[model samples]
Target chain A: MLLLITRTFKESIRSILRNGWLSVSTISILVMSLYIISVFFVFTSTANEMLKEIKNKANISVYFKADAEEGVILAAKTEVEKMNEVKSVEYISKEVALENFKRTNANEPVILESLKEIGGNPLLAALVVRANNPTDYQTIDENITKATFSEEVSRVNYNKNKELINKLNSVIETIQKIGISLGLLFAAISLLITFNAVRITIYTHKQEIEIMRLVGASNMFIRLPFIFEGIIYGIVSSVVSVLLLFISLKFIASYVSLTIPTVSLMNFYLANFGTILGYQILLGSFFGVIGGLMAMRKYLKV
Target chain B: MINEENIQEEKNKIMIKFDNVSKTYKGDFMALEEINLDIAEGEFISVVGQSGSGKSTLLKLIYAEEAATVGEVYFDGNPLSVVRKKNLSAHRREIGTVFQDFKLLPRKTVYENVAYALEVSGAPDEEIAENVPQILDIVGLTTKAKKYPHQLSGGEQQKVAIARALVHTPMIIVADEPTGNLDPIASLEIVRLLIRINELGTTVVLASHDKDIVDKANKRVLVLENGRIIADYPQGKYKIS
Candidate 1:
C-alpha cells in the first residue's frame, strides 16, 4: 500500500512536469477563481462590519412636553429601557440639554447673546433610545407611541429618520444580494473553464490511460495518479492566491483605512487568516478534484 | 457423452476455452460467430486473418476486455464474464497484453515504461528495482533503457512493450499485430522474441496479418475469415494463394 501511494505520487508529479503548459494553465485558472472568491469574501466582510457600525450608532431622541413634569420624563426613560428592542436609554435632563445647546453654539456669539436675552432655558428633557438592531427601531417607535406616558411626550423622533434608516438598510441588502449572485456566477464560470481544461488534459493522455488499462492496472491505480495531480494543482494555486491576496491586502491596507475607517480589510484578513486559508484550500481542491473526476468518467469505462 | 468429453478436456489443464462464442456489435454487425477453440498451457498459437476477421475480438475475449455476445469464454475453467468487475485486474494480471502501436508512454523512459507495469500491479519497490533490469536485459534493451519511445527505433519500442508484458511474469502473453508498426527486419525480431518467450514456458498468442512472419512461425495456426475460423492447422503455413 505504501509503495502504491509512493508510485502514484511519483507518477502524478511526473505527469504534471510532463504537461507543463496544461498544469500552468489549470493552476492559473484555479488561482484566478480563488482570488476572486477571496476578494468577495473581504468585500462582504468589510461591508458587514460597516453596516454593524452604522446600526450601532443609530438611535432616536424622544423629547418630553416642555411643561411636563420631570418625574414623568424619568418614568418614560425607565419605560423605554424596559422594552425588549431597546438596547439602552440615556436621559438628558433639562439642565444638561441647555448646557449641550450652549456648548454646541459656543463659537456663535449671536446665539449666546440670544440665549442670555431669552433668560430661562427653552430646552426640554429627552430620552435617547437605541435598539439592538436597525430593523427593531420601528417596533420600538410603535411601542413608545402606545406607552402610558405617550401623552406626555411631545414627539417621537424615530419617524423623522425612518426613511433614511430604511433606505440605508435596503441599499446594504441590495449590495449583499448582488455580491453573492456575482460571486456565484464567477465561480460557476471558472469551474466550467477548469473542467474543460482538465478534460483536454485527459484527452491528450487518452493513449496513456488506455495503455495503463491494458497493462492490468486496477481502476483505482489508474485513477489515483490523476487525482493526486489535481490535488497538487489545487494546493499550488491556493498557496499562490493566498500569498498574493496577503501581499495585495497589505499594500492596499493603508489606503483603504484612510477612505473607509469604519472597516479595515487588512485587519479582517489578518484576524481570520487561518480560516481564510482553510476555506481557499478546501474550495480550490474541491473544484480541482471535481473537474478531474468529471474528465475521468468517460475514459475509465475501460 | 459430450459432457464426459468436456470433463476430460477440463482435466487436461486447458488454459483457455471458447465455447460457441459469438460477438455482435450494435445489434447487427457480427464481429465473431460461433467460435470454438481450446488452448492448452504453455502453447504458442498464431491467429492469422485479414482485417476485421475478429482476430482482435478473440484476443479481447480471452482477457475479458470484451465479453462474448452470445456464449461463454473460460480462462482456467472460470467463465470470463462471471468474474466481478473489481476482480478483472487480478485476472488480467495473469495475462499480459501487447498492442501494434507499442502503446508506450512517450513521456516515460523505456525503463519507466516497463517498470510502470509492475508499479500499477503494486509490486514491491525492491522487486521492481530488481526485476525491471532483468526483463530489460532479456528484451535486449538494457543499454537503451534510459531512452524515450521517440528516441528508440520501432523495433526497440516493441521490445520495450514485450518487456512490459513480461514484467508481471504472466502465464499468457497476448500480442495484437505487435509488429504492425515495424519494418520487416524488426517484425522478424519480434517474432523471434515471442518464440523465445514461449520456450520459457509462457503461453504466447500472436495475432498477425504478416504472412512471412506467421508462416515462418510454423506453430498451431487458426485462420479466421469474417468472424469464423476457416481452418485450424497443427503446423500451418500462410496460404494466401
Candidate 2:
C-alpha cells in the first residue's frame, strides 16, 4: 500500500512536470481564483469592521441641567443600563465633559480663547446611551423623556441625530447586502472558471487514462494518480496565491489606512493567516479534486 | 450429462473455451457467429482474417472487453459473463493485452511504461524493480529503458508494449494487430518475440491481416471470413490469400 501510494505520487509529479505548460496554466487559474476569494474575504471583513465602528459611534448623549447633581446623573445611567434595548450608559460629569470639549476644540485658537474666557466649566452633565439596535435609540430616548425626573434632563440629542442615524443604518444594510451578493457572485464565477480549467487539463490526459485502464489497473489505482495531481496543483497554487496576497495586501493596507486609519488590511490578513490559508487550501483542493473527478468520470468507464 | 469432474479435467487442459459464441454489434451487425473453440494451455494461436472479419472481436472476447451476444466464453472454466463487474480487473490482470496502437503512455519512459503494469497489480517495489528490468531485457529494450515511446522506433514501441504485457507474467498475451504499424523487419521481430514467449509456457493470441507475418508464425491458425471461421489448421501457414 505504501509502495502504491509512493509510486502514484511519483507518477503524479512526473506527469505535472511532463506537461509543464499545461500544469502551469492550470495552477495559474487556481491561483487567480483563490486570490480573488481571499481578496473578497478581506474586503468584507474590513467593511464589516467599519460598519461596526460606525454603529458604535452612533450613540445618543442626554444632557442634564447645569445644576443637576452627580447622584441624579449616576442614577439615570444605571436606569438606562437596565433597559433591554440599551447596550450601555455612560455618566459624564460636567468637569469631564468640559475637558472633552477643550480637547476637541484645541486645534482652533478662537475656540481655546473662548473656553479660557469662560473661566468656570459651564458644560452640563450627561448620560451617553448606546443601543443594541440602531432603531432602538428612539425607544430609549422616549423612555428617558417620560421618566419621573425628566425635568432634571435639559435635552435628549436623539431627535437631533435621528435622520443621520437612520441614514447610517440604511447605508450599513445596503453595504451588507451588496457584500453578500458580491461574495456569492465571485464564488460562483471562480468555481466555474476553475472547473473549466480542470476539465481542459483532464481532457489532455484522457488517452493516458484509457491506456492506464487497459493495463488492468484497478479503478482506484488509475484514479489515485490523477487525484494526487490535482492535490499537488492545489498545494502549489495556494502557496503562490498566499504569497501574492501578502504582497498585494501590503499595498492595499497602506492605501486604505489613509481613509480609515483603524483598518489595516495587512494586519487583518496576518491575524487570520491560519484561517485564510486553511480556506485557500480547502477551496483549492476541493475545486481541483472535484473538477478532476467530474472530468474523468466519462473517461474512467473504460 | 457432463459432470463437474469432466469440466475440471477440460479446464486443466484448456485455458480458454468459446462455446458457440456469437457477438453482434449495434444495428444488427454480427461480428462473430456461433464460434466454438478451445485453446489449450501454452498454445500459440494466430487468428488471421481480412478487415471486418472478426479477428479483433475474437481477441476482445478472451480479454472480456466485449460480451458475446449469443453463447458463452469461459476462461479456465469460469464463464466471462459470470465474472462480477468489480472482478473484471482481476480477470484482466491474468491476461495481458496488446493493441495495434501500442497504447503506451506518451509521458512515461520505457521503464515506467513496463513498470506501470506491475505497479497497477499492487506489486511491491522490490518485485517491480526486479521484474521490470528483466522483462525489458527479454524484449531487447534494456538499453532504451529511459527513452519515451515517441523517442523509439515502431518496433521498439511494440517491444515496450510486449514488455509491459509480460511484466506481470500473465497466463495469456493477446496482441490485436500489434505489428500493423510496424515495418516487415519490425513485424518479424514482434512475431519471433511472441513465439519465444509462447515457448516459455504462455498462451499467445496474435490477430493480424499481414499474410507474411501470419505465414511466418507457422503456429495453429484460425482463419475467419465474414465473422465465420472458415479453417482451423494445426501448424498452418496463412491460406486465405
Candidate 3:
C-alpha cells in the first residue's frame, strides 16, 4: 500500500504537470478560496486584538472624601492591590490631582485663576484600580468597599464609569462572536467550493481514471495520483493566495493604517511570517487531500 | 473433439462457464439468452456473429460488465454476478479488455498507456520501465513508444491498445469489435496482432463481424443469433446471412 501510495503521488504530479491548463485552473480556484478565508481570519483577529488593547486602557478611579487624609487612600490602594482580581492600583494625591487639573485646564484662563483664587488644592485623593479582565472589576470593586478604611471613601468612582465599560464590553464581544461565526461559515463554504472544483476536474478526466482502473491498478494505487494532484493544487493556490494578500495588503494596508491609526498589516504579516506560512500550508494541504479524496471517489471504486 | 468437450462439460476443469446466461435491455428485447458455454484453459477462440447478435453481450458478460437475467458467469473459480464492486478491479485485472475505440488514454504516450495497467497493479518503476517497452515491442510499437495517441494512426493506436491488453499478461483477452474502426489492411493488422497474441498461449475471445478475419482464424467459434448460440464448431465462418 505504501509503495502504491508513492507511485500514485508521483503519477498524479506528473499528470497535473502534463495537463497545463488543468493545473492552472485547479491551483487558481484553490488559491482564491484560501485567500478569501485568510483575509477574513486576519480582519477579525486584528479587530479582536485592537479591542483588547482598548479594554486594557480602561480603569476604575475611586475619588476619596475632601477631608480624608492621603494615608487612608494609600491604605485603600494597598488593599485593592492585594485582591486577587486587581491587576494594578495607583494612588493619586490631592496635590498631584490639583496639578493635573491645572495642567489640563492651562489653555482656559478663567478656570486657571479660579483654581488660584481657591489658594488651595481643591481635589480629592483617589486610587485608580485596574482589573485583570473587564469582568473582574465588579468583584475587585466590592473588595475595596469591604476594606477597613471604607469610611474614608466618599464613593467608589467606579459607579460613574461602570455602565459605560459594561456597554462597550458587550459591543466588543458581539462583534467578535459574529466575526467568528461568519469566518467559520465562509471557511466551510470556501472549502466546499475548492473540493467541488477538484471533483469536477477529476470528473472531466474520468475516462483516464477508468482506463487506469481497468489495467489492473489497485484502488489505493490510483488514488495516490489524485491526492498528489490535490496537494500540488493546494500548495500552488496557497502561494498565490499569500502573494495576492501580500501585494494587496502592501497597497491597501498603508491607507487602512492611516485611516484607522491602529493596526499595520505589513508589520503584522511580517512579524507573523512563519505562523502565516505554516497556517497557509496546513490549510492548502488539508483542502487538497480532502478535495482529491472526494473527487477520486468514483475512479477509486472500480 | 466435440464429444470429448461434452463428456468433460459437467466437470469443474473449465476456466470459464456461462450457465444459462441471458441479458435483456430496458425493453423486452433480449440481447442474449440461455448462453451455456465452457472454455478450457489457454484456448484461443473467437465469437463471430452479426451486428445485433449477442456476441458483444457474451463478451461483456464474461467480464461481468452486464449481469445476466437468468444465470451466472464463472471466471477462473469466482462467480462474477455476486462479486462486489470493490472486487471488480481484481476481477478485471485477471482479464484484459480491448474495445473497438482503442480506449487509450489520450494524455498518455504509447509507453505510458501500456505501463498504466502495470502501474495500477502497484508494479515498481523498474518493472514498468522494463515491461512496458518490451510489450510495446511485442505489439511492434517499440519504434513509436514516445508518440501520443493522436500522433498514431488507427492501426498504431489499436496496437497500443493491444499492448495495453497484453501488458498484464492476463489469462483471457475480451475484445469487442477491436477492428471496427480500421480499414481492411489495418483490420488485418489487428487480426494478425490478436492471432499473434493468441499464439503466446493466452485465451483470446474476439467478437468481430469482418468475414475475412473470422474465416481465416479456423479456431473454436461460437455463433449467436436472437440471443441464442445457434451454431458451435471446431472451426466456423461469419454466417451473417
Winning candidate number (lDDT): 1
Q: How many angstroms is the interface RMSD of candidate 2?
A: 1.5
Model 1 chain A weakest lDDT span, ten residues long = A159-168
Best by DockQ: 1
The order by descending TM-score is 1, 2, 3
Alpha-carbon local distance difference test for all models: 0.86, 0.84, 0.78
What is the C-alpha lDDT profile of model 3 across B1-241, one tens digit per residue? Answer: 9988777765425788989887888888899888899887767677887878888888888876777888888888778877635587777777899998999988789998888788778777799898888898888989998889999999999899988988878888989988889998998888888888888878889888778777777678888788889888877676655
Across A83-141, the per-residue lDDT of candidate 2 in tens digits comes to 89989888888989988988898899998898789889989888888889877887988
Identify the superior model by DockQ, candidate 1 or candidate 3: 1
TM-score of the A chain in candidate 2: the value is 0.83
Docking class of 2: medium
Q: Give per-residue lDDT, candidate 2, residue B230.
A: 95
List native contact recovery per candidate, as a fraction of 1: 0.76, 0.60, 0.86
Question: What is the per-residue lDDT of model 1 for residues A13-110, given as tens digits with 9 covering 90 to 100?
Answer: 98789778877888887888888778778877877777677776778889899899988888888888999988999999889999999999999999
| DockQ of each model vs. true complex | 0.65, 0.55, 0.57
Q: What TM-score would each prediction reach against the true structure? A: 0.86, 0.84, 0.79
Candidate 3's docking class is medium
Candidate 3 residue A158 Cα shift, in angstroms, is 3.7
For candidate 2, write residues B80-163 as lDDT tens digits.
997636577788888888888999988789999998887776888799889988999899999999999999999999999999
Flag regions of model 3 displaced more than 4 Å: A1-7, A14-29, A66-125, A131-151, A159-196, A250-267, A288-301, B1-12, B24-30, B68-70, B82-84, B146-153
